[model samples]
Target chain A: MSGAFYLATRYMRRHRGKTAVMVAAVTLTLLLPLAVTVLVRAYDRQLGERAAATPMVVGAAGNRYDLVLQALYFRAGRVGTVPASLADDAERDGMAVGIPLHVRYTAQDAPVVGTDLAEYAAFRGLTVAEGDWPRMLGQAVLGHDAAERLGLGPGDTLTTDQQNLYNLARNMPLRLRVVGVLAPTHSPDDRAVFVSLRTCWLIGGHGHGHAPEIHDDEALHRAARLAVEVTEDNVDSFHFHGDMDALPLSAVIVLPDSDKSRTILTARFNQATPGVQALDPPTVMDELMGLVFRVKRFFDANFALVLLATGLLLGLVVTLSLKLRTAERRTLHLLGCGRWLIVQTQAIELGLVLGLSAALACGLAGALTLLAPRWLGV
Target chain B: MIELTDVRFRYDASASGAFELRVDRLALGAGSRTAVVGPSGSGKTTLLHLIAGILTPVQGRVVVNQEELGGLPDAQRRRARLRSMGMVFQDIQLLDYLSVRDNILLPYRLGGGLVLDREAKDRAESLANRVGLGDKLGRAIDKLSQGERQRVAICRALIARPELLLADEPTSALDADTARATLNLVFELAEETGTTLVVLTHDPSVLERFDRVVHVDGGGVS
Candidate 1:
């Protein structure tokens, strides 16, 4: 048997082109399903991991899936927002660490995540790849991919994207200077721009700077126009009116200390609030994966069909190869090879083809797993 | 070392009387050279196969080196043939995928009885050198010419140090000069190894070199 295997390998090497074609064909057949499974499983696992990191998410309760996407992925939508006061209320009892998110704006097409830098960095496991974290209101930190995509680095500046292309009465876009770049985590955060909550309010027209109160409304308008770019000289001039807690937030990520507190929070806001919902992210993502599994089943059936067709084709090839090797088989028989040895020789060739295909399939699967995040951005 | 008695064998095609072999009695002493001469389809190749134990008689005894081969199982028969009887086909059936040395050592690998230990390896190497193929040991069979390939086959046949060597029209395809030379190599190698050589040939000029000559016509050897 071992000699047969050696002969098979030798023959395979001799007919390199035929063996390569067969190996390539079989590799593609195995790779399609293997890569699909590995990448989808990686995506599913990634989604589940990110969702699990945030145990509890609170947002306006219009659509559970939409809120989950908004809280966990920072997906832009017309979904309603909750007040910043809700985050305070959730954290006041010392039951959880409530972090507010204000995701209203973008800078150069990257989402501007207005968050408390320390808490958001801790929750997301973000470490600065370069420079330092933002220390003032007008500074920003770029996510790993965002920095690379925009070709921006520390000490560079980016203007906030215009909010009202159709409305001339809206607040003007502000200028934000880049202070740091975050390490690549292969998450949605890799595509975000992080800014302080105060900067978010500044862009929302909730705050403005004025040197002095002048008599003319035109002068105040001019003063407000002059405050578009926040700087160290104008830092003290920035202020917001009314209660700060009443400011708007896209969502509140609640990291509950215990399962009981998580359940209590979920029950407290589960359909009780008029326009807010507090739910577990993992549960919502499970529902999303349920829908994904249905799509995957279609691929699984198609993959099985392709596999069956490939197997039939390989069988036909083997049969034809056996017919062609009749004279060689006779020669082997005359060379003292038995019926079993003859069969083993043929089997070894096929096994080599299959073994090479399997190895190629595994390599394809591995590459898919590593690159799916960058390709699909999941 | 080689004997056959009351041998009766036929191919499935022989049901209609196309091909059959019946050798009443045959014997060859060790280290002797004998040639069985006949035309094509005259059972010359079939006689060689039966004597080599590659084909079994319908009901008779064939012995090589005093070991009865007709009643052995398929594996044992193959092993016995591989170990004691070496065969050279008319077309020089060397596996082109194997290098020259590997082709020569193929019998040892197949028989499973001959240990490919250092001694057998040394024999294969020396045999290649004897046949002027030592430098071409690792070369593929396709790289060799007709004469070189024929020499490879002879070296392969003798590598097992078998007691009986069978050659089936081994020189029919070569030129007359190369044919004579290849037969001379086979004769000299067999004499040196002290093995009985049974060569089946249609070339009468080469038969005079054999000490004994047997003629076959139809199904019986005379």
Candidate 2:
């Protein structure tokens, strides 16, 4: 056996170029299918874990996928808004706790999540890893990845991105002070910047603070481009002009007291409200993943065919190689080589090729799976 | 010593015509240097293979080293040939992927009942040095000249210190100077080891150097 192995190693080393090409071909053939399976499993677990945690989502009557995605992942779509008062109505009915969401803007390309920090943080199991929560108006708390990406910590300031620079009616960008950073949750929450709902409304031009000397209404009617910074000294002057209950919210995440309460609340919002719709997040996510898995099945079939073709090609290569080595085999035979030894030598060579290719495929697959979250921004 | 009595062998019939060889009786003494001179398609290589137990005859007994190979099983016959004989093929068939040293050590790796130890390796290197290939042991077969490759083949055949050495056209493709040197090396090694030597050749100049000459024509040896 050792003698057979020695000859096999020598042959492979001497013809290293052919060996390397064969190894690479087999590695890619194994890597493609292995990498796809690993990535799909990771996606399934990640999506399922997050979706199963949220109970229901209420938003404008439009694409329910958009509403659930906006409520859970803060991925804004074309879905319109619902009244912020819906959260209070759900709480008042003693059925469920509603966490209102206002996900209209971005800060440094990270979604800005405007909600009640005390309630939303508890609901999502978010805790401050550094400094305090967003306590004052215009104060911001960043998620772990958000803080790392923005390179901001406590006492630093962040500015919201302006939606339109040319429009005169658009609100001026707000400069927010970073107060805290949340620990990693490994969800979409890690990519968000959390702030108070009033601060978000202020950024939307619903409120402003001005110089104390401007006492006249005509002076108060300044252009929307006039920027505002809420400092501790002038924070008391900032107030909203419209009814607070009529404020726009992108979606509401409802956590019910029981199965009965959930069914009643879902019915109340889905049937009674004219333009508002409530949906189960897990059901919507399952349908979406079903489509994703259907596509994966097609890819799996294609990879199977590729593997078959690779196998056939490898078979042809081995056959041709044996044919080419007929003279060499005869030489070994005349040199007193046994028939069994010849077969053993060639078998060991094939085993070495396949073993190296399998190891490379596994290493590459594991690396790609580990990097999928960072690459896909999960 | 080797003996063949009434050996009759025929090639399998194909598109090419069938040919047969018949040797009524032939005897080669121990440590004798003999030459087999034959025309093309006259079965010189077939005669060498028969003496080495590589081919079986229809109605004859091939006795090599005092064992009748025709009565032995296939495996025992192979073992006897591997242990007691060495052969150099007509084409100098060295594996192209191996270096000169490995090509010389191939018999020990081929399950030939030879143990490959440090002493065996030393003997292989020593034979290569004797054949003027000591410095070129690490070079690939394709990198060597035709004469150098022929010398390597001779070294491989002699590495086992076999009692009998059979060579087919060992110097056929060499220039006169290299051919003489290669033949001289073979004679020196065989004489030093007291090995029986049989060489098949078509060159007339090679006949005078042997103790006895056998001629084959029309599938019969005289």
Off by over 4 Å in 2: A165-169, A209-230, A233-238
Q: What value does DockQ give for candidate 1? A: 0.44
* DockQ for each model: 0.44, 0.67
Candidate 2 chain A: worst 10 consecutive residues by lDDT? A218-227
Q: How would you encode candidate 1's per-residue C-alpha lDDT over B31-116 as one tens digit per residue?
A: 88999998777888888888877788997888877888887888888888788778888999888878998889888766547777
Comparing to the true complex, what docking class would candidate 2 get? medium
Among the numbered candidates, top TM-score falls to 2
Native contacts recovered, each model: 0.47, 0.72
Provide a comma-separated list of chain B TM-scores, one per candidate.
0.94, 0.96
Cα deviation at A49, candidate 1, in Å, is 3.4
> What TM-score does candidate 2 get on C-alpha atoms?
0.93
Q: Clashing pairs in model 2?
A: none
Model 2, position B118: C-alpha lDDT score: 99
lDDT of 1: 0.86
lDDT (0 to 1) per candidate: 0.86, 0.88
Clashes within 3 Å, all models in order: 0, 0
